[model samples]
Target: MAAPYRSREGLSTRPGAYGGSSDEIQLRIDPMHGDFDEEVSGLRKQVRKLRDVAQEIETEAKFQNDFLNQLMEKVLMPTALRNELPD
Candidate 1:
């Protein structure tokens, strides 16, 4: 036979339940007034900073690629071409 079900105020009757007093469980239903605004502002600032950093990195990468290509064309290719010329 199964045990009968019981209902207690602010208490759980399930097996392996947290056996603490109801006062330990605190519930908050407050509205997000100022904290939400502050959090959104902080997130926007961080996103802007990250975007600026990404742009800088992209610019630096493009400059480095161009410099490397110029070096190959002006220095390495001429040397290679001279070696291929008839003596």
Candidate 2:
């Protein structure tokens, strides 16, 4: 069986002398310290930096692969066929 929900005006519940609810009475409270906006901004900056680095790495890898493919076709193919020709 569920207990009935009561509004603040209808209920007699009050914080103790220390100004905390009974459920939270036993726990020691810490002061709030974090700036949410600054933390989010820092994370956004890190993400942008990582995204830029990843894009640079991807572009370099693609260029290297294409260059290697062209070098192989232009240099190795003729040399290999020359070596394999009947002489």
- Candidate 2 clash figure, as a count: 0
State how far residue 72 of model 2 sits from its true place (Å): 1.3
Backbone clash count, each prediction separately:
0, 0
User: Alpha-carbon error at 44 in model 1, in Å?
Assistant: 0.6
TM-score of each: 0.57, 0.57
Off by over 4 Å in 1: 1-34
Q: Which segments of model 2 are wrong by more than 4 Å?
A: 1-31
Cα lDDT, all candidates = 0.59, 0.61
RMSD of each: 17.8, 19.0
Q: Give a tens-digit lDDT track for model 1, residues 1-87.
A: 122222222222333337643323221223543455654575577669979999999999999999999988998888999999999
Model 2: residue 3 alpha-carbon error in angstroms = 48
How far out, in Å, is residue 31 in model 2?
A: 7.0
Per-residue lDDT for 1-87 in model 2, tens only?
Answer: 122222212223345568654521122223375555655575577669979999999999999999999988999889999999999
Clashing pairs for predicted structure model 1, backbone only: none
